[model samples]
Every structure is written in C-alpha cells, then in structure tokens.
Target chain A: MLSVTPQHFLILSFLLVGIGFLGLLIRRNVLLMLMSLELMLNGINVALLTFSRVGSNLDGGIFVFFIMTVAAAEVAVGLALLVALYKKRNSVLSDDMGLLKN
Target chain B: MNAVDLLFWLFAVLSVGGGLSMVFSRHPVSAAMFMIVSLVGVAALFVLLESFFLAILQVLVYAGAVMVLFLFIIMLLDVGPEAGKGKLSHFKTGIFGLLATVLLVGILLTLGNSYDSLALDQSIWPELSESKDGASHSLPFSTKVSSFGYGLMTKYMLPIQVSGFMLLAAMVGVIILSKKTPDREDLK
Candidate 1:
C-alpha cells in the first residue's frame, strides 16, 4: 500500500472516465452532461501525463496541451448551444428537446 | 508510506470522490463545484508526476477558466436542483448503470492483467540534455518550461497554429449560436 505505481494512476483515470460516462447517461440536464464530458477529458489527461512520465517523452504533455485547447473550445460551443436551447425550450432537461425522437 | 505516496493517495481520493459526488449531486452549481475539487486534485497529481508547468496549466485552465464558464452558464440559465428522481426510467437507468459497471470492471481487469509490464523500475523524472553548440537538436524530455517552449516552436508549431484557428472558429460559432436573430421566431 505504501508504494504508488503507474497502475494506480491508470486505475484512477479509468474510474474517472467511468463515473463521467455514468453521469452522461443518467443525467438529463444538458449542463450536467457537458460537465461529465469535461470529467472524461480530465481523465484522459491524467492517462496522457502518466504515459508521458513513464516513457520519458514530452510529446504526451504537448498532446495534453492541445487537448486542453480543444476542450476549452468544446465547452464554449457546448455552453453556447445550451444557452440557445434553453432560450428556445425554457428547460434544460434533455427529454424536453427531443424533436427528432419521432 | 512516504510523502509522495501519502499525497498521491490523498489527491486520488479527493479526485475520485469529487467525481462521484459530481455525478450524484442534485444541484448543477454543486456539481460544478465538485468538478473544481476534482480538477484541483488532478492538478496535484500532475505535480506528483513532476510536470510543474502542466500542473499549473491544469489549475489555471480547468479550475479557473473552464469552471467559471460552467458556473456562469448554470447561474445564467438558472438551473434549479433536479427533482427527487431522474428523468430516466427505472429500466433505462438499470441498463445504463449496468453498462457503466461492466465497462469499469473490464478496464480494471485489463489493467490488473498488465500490472507487471506497467511497473516502473527506473526513475521517471526527466533530465535536461546538454548540447555542445547552441543549435537546435532533438530536445530531451524535461520538466523545464524551456523544453516545452522549444518543442512548441519547433516540433509542434503547426498544431499550435491549427489550434488557434480552431479556437477562432469556435468563437465565431458561439457568437452565431447565441446571437438573437431578427427574423428567427425560435430565438424570440
């Protein structure tokens, strides 16, 4: 229990992704769902940094840099869309915006 | 356990616990707050990995900027606490829950099987390599900001430019999406 290994970090990454996925599925609120997406991205970052450290490679860190860039863009677009949807529907629940379900 | 080990466990629990709570929390604001907690924990993990620059970036970018955006949206939309029950029915919830569980278990099993191969016997700390001349050669991996700067300007110059373009496009898209159109009845 005293020694921390790469496996432990990997497990944490997987757990975070798992929880984020669960949130995405069960949560009806679009905002919560987007937050879950951020959680998943963060999990991936942990794994990337772990591999970067393990292989003594700097590319993984740089890749994470790009991932963050994309994530910031994604959240901006996603929230903007959410705001638009809320304005139209007057509700944040995913079930309320099911125009294509039929 | 040593200090590193202790800190690792501490932040590990903090991150994982915060993630779990974020999923189950009723209020959007609380969930966003939990995400901040989780992000801070991940930043600590980055520090443990000896990537001081990335760790600071994680804090500044995720916990600071992204989270503020989330909070602003939550408050702007006035997202109230979810009702006592979720919108997902019992059967759909059960199916999704089982799927998530199986995925997590499968990942755990795979990692466990590969545990031996993943164990590191040598120090993972990066060391800066010395160059005979001041010319740019293949840069050795290090935790120094200079290494990152050099790598970005030399090897990753294209990607950085592309990312900038992408950000610009996303900014335009957000403005278009959120702007009130004069003729569109839906936005009104």
Candidate 2:
C-alpha cells in the first residue's frame, strides 16, 4: 500500500476550506453559500480522519460520524428555511434575510 | 506510487475539480449534483485512509441524504439556471477571492513537500506483524463482533444520543421559522 501521509490530507483539507471560504465571500446566492458550508464541513471531516489514522484512535472517526449527522440535519433545516424566506422575499440573497436585527 | 496512493491521488483530483465546479456553476441543480460527486470522492478517499466505518457514513449521509435535501430545495424554489444568473456584487469580492487563493497556496507550501517522513508517525505505522500474528493475545473470531458492539454501545454512546436531539431541534426550528405569515397570505 502506498502510504498516505497526514500532510497530504492536510493539504486537501486546506484546499477545500479555502475554496469554501471564497464561495461564502463571493457568492450572492444563499443556496450557494450553503453548498460552500458543506465543503468546509467535509474539509473538517477529512482532517478528523487524518488524525484518526495517524493517532490510532477510533474517536476521531466516530466524531466525524456525528458531525456528518449534524451537517445533514443542518442542511435540511437550513433549506426549508431558505424556501420559506424565498416565499416571503422572492429572493435568496444572504443580504435579504433580515429576520435578525442586532 | 502504490495502489493506495494512486487511488488517493485520483480521487483527490476528482473531488477538488468537482468541488470547484460545484462552487462556480451558475445552475443550482448542477451545483447540487456536482456537490454529490465531490462527496463521493471524499468517501473514496476515506476508504483509502483505512477508516471503513467513516467511509460508509460519508456515502450514506453526505452524498445520499444531504444531496437529496439540497435537490429538493432547488426544485421547490425553482431556482434554476435562469434564476441563478444576475448582476455582480462588486470588485471587492474579486479581491477577496485573490486573497483566499494566495493564503491557500501559502498553507500548502508551509506543510511542505509531502516527501517528508515526519508526516508519518509511530501511531500510523502498520500494525506490527507480531501483534496481528499473536493468536494467543489477540481477539477470537466470534468475540470480535460482540466486542466491537459493546465498545461502541458503552464507550462512545454519547454522540449517538446527541445527534438524535440535534436532528429534532433543527427540524422543529425549520418548521417554525418557515411558517407562512398570515398578512402575506392574505395580501396574495
């Protein structure tokens, strides 16, 4: 087996995260922003598995499973909310969801 | 390169490319579909990393379940390609993109040369042949499954319970927040 290094995994994770950040910053559409969030979460999962493999603990992998479930639930709820917002405003721009006043 | 390394490189390329396309694509449904491809590649990469449990979870959760939700929303919203295209925000977003790219390249280089051995540590070194071969000290055939079951049920049960609550909370929150406003419906 060709050995996979933690650093290699780190590089991949960083790429995914950077792209996600870029997507979040540049995209006007809320749905696209959510897609970018998934990219960022997957990047974190990759880092977790890399640690799990290198550290010889099953805990990181287990944590990733939880993270995945959380992410799934988050997507479901976020989209439903997005759909509702679209009904009100006829748009899904990040700037338009002004429900929370600070 | 060994087979595992080769597979890793292949899937990594596929994932990264698919992910970029997903982000930049103008069509909402295509973006969601490309995201699924990116997810599948990540799952394949997980398998290469020797975490069988994680790989399966990735396939079933992110690729299968999450994508379905995303697709459902895209279809429901009718945010097709025509809906996605629009006027640009400002040139500042371009600057931010440039900054992000440079920072990412910097991180990649800082990690430096995957050729280094420090990347491999004692923990990851393949299980010592002696340990796996030691039949006397190792687990027996029938006990392996039961032992794993007990370990998960006992040692790492908290996460399982938390995930259930998280789902419930998210579902209720989404429902409450999305309810139609009486005024808006009356106006229509």
Strongest candidate by lDDT: 1
- Candidate 1 TM-score versus the reference: 0.94
How do the residues B78-174 of candidate 2 rate in per-residue lDDT, one tens digit apiece? 8766352445645776788888889888878877754475465543334523233433333212212343344356666676777788888988888
lDDT agreement with native, every candidate? 0.89, 0.76
Give the Å error, residue A22, model 1: 1.0
TM-score of each: 0.94, 0.83
Scored against the true structure, residue A102 in model 2 reaches a CA lDDT of 75
- Candidate 1 — which residues are off by over 4 angstroms? B84-86, B122-139, B186-188
DockQ of 2: 0.55
State the lDDT of candidate 1 residue by residue for B48-117, as single tens digits: 9888999999999999999999999999989899886656788998899999999999999999999888
| Model 2 bad stretches (over 4 Å) | A1-3, A98-102, B82-90, B113-117, B121-125, B128-151, B179-188
